[model samples]
Target: MTAVKFLSDEYLDELGDLVTPDLPEVPHVNVRLQFHATDTPEGEVDYHLVAERGVVVRAGRGLLADSDLAIRASYRDLLAFESGELHAATAFVTGQFAVTGDRAKVLDLMVVLQSGNYQRFIADLWARTTW
Candidate 1:
């Protein structure tokens, strides 16, 4: 079987689509992800994504400093979770993911994920995983 890989950019794009419809009409929110490698010797990588008016306006270093939420996860773990091979709750329970910043925002994001549209999110994730 081919191993799955989750690029930070692809992950941000899929997450933006997943939450856009469910998010309130806020001005904008910046979210940064600091990905740490639990199994690799390499340090960590930072990914930034900006959402505005239910659209992703920016991603990568173009994102602003202030963020509504920040999350930490290993690349492998994130890929697994995105592919639906691992559940978010289970990942959290197993210490594979950690979230910080606005807890409410995180919860809202989760609500969106749990909603019926999650199927679309899963499809997008599958495409990215195989790409």
Candidate 2:
């Protein structure tokens, strides 16, 4: 299968499909997370995920109205994280990833993000993404 450009319309469509099946059921992780990846070859890429009861109810380009968390980072850094070269927590700890939101919400969200299913989601994303 041919890979899609990162953050392309086709890629987002793929991500949207992955959400319902891939996301684990963890109600406490409910949150709207906005992701901003700046300085990409195609300029900036922005997206958001609205998860309720551990399932993503919405996924789309740009920001959501009331996100529980907003993560901003360089496209390179984000690519590294998604591609398995850098770990998400390591990126956050090293200041490569900037997040603004409730601390408790972050903890809750981490549960789902740290799950094995999430890892599978990342692997699937890596497979479909074009560097």
The lDDT leader among the candidates is: 2
Clashing pairs in 2: none
Which residue ranges in model 2 land beyond 4 Å of their true spot?
Answer: 21-24
For 41-67, candidate 2 gives per-residue lDDT tens digits of: 778888887777776677867778788
lDDT, candidate 1, 1-131, per-residue tens: 23334554444455455544454543433333333334422335566555444334445423346777766787678667767788877876676788767766654455434544456756755775652
The candidate scoring highest on TM-score is 2
Q: Give lDDT for model 1.
A: 0.55
Note the residue pairs that clash in candidate 1. none
- TM-scores of the models, in the order given: 0.56, 0.87
Worst 10 residues of 2 by lDDT: 18-27
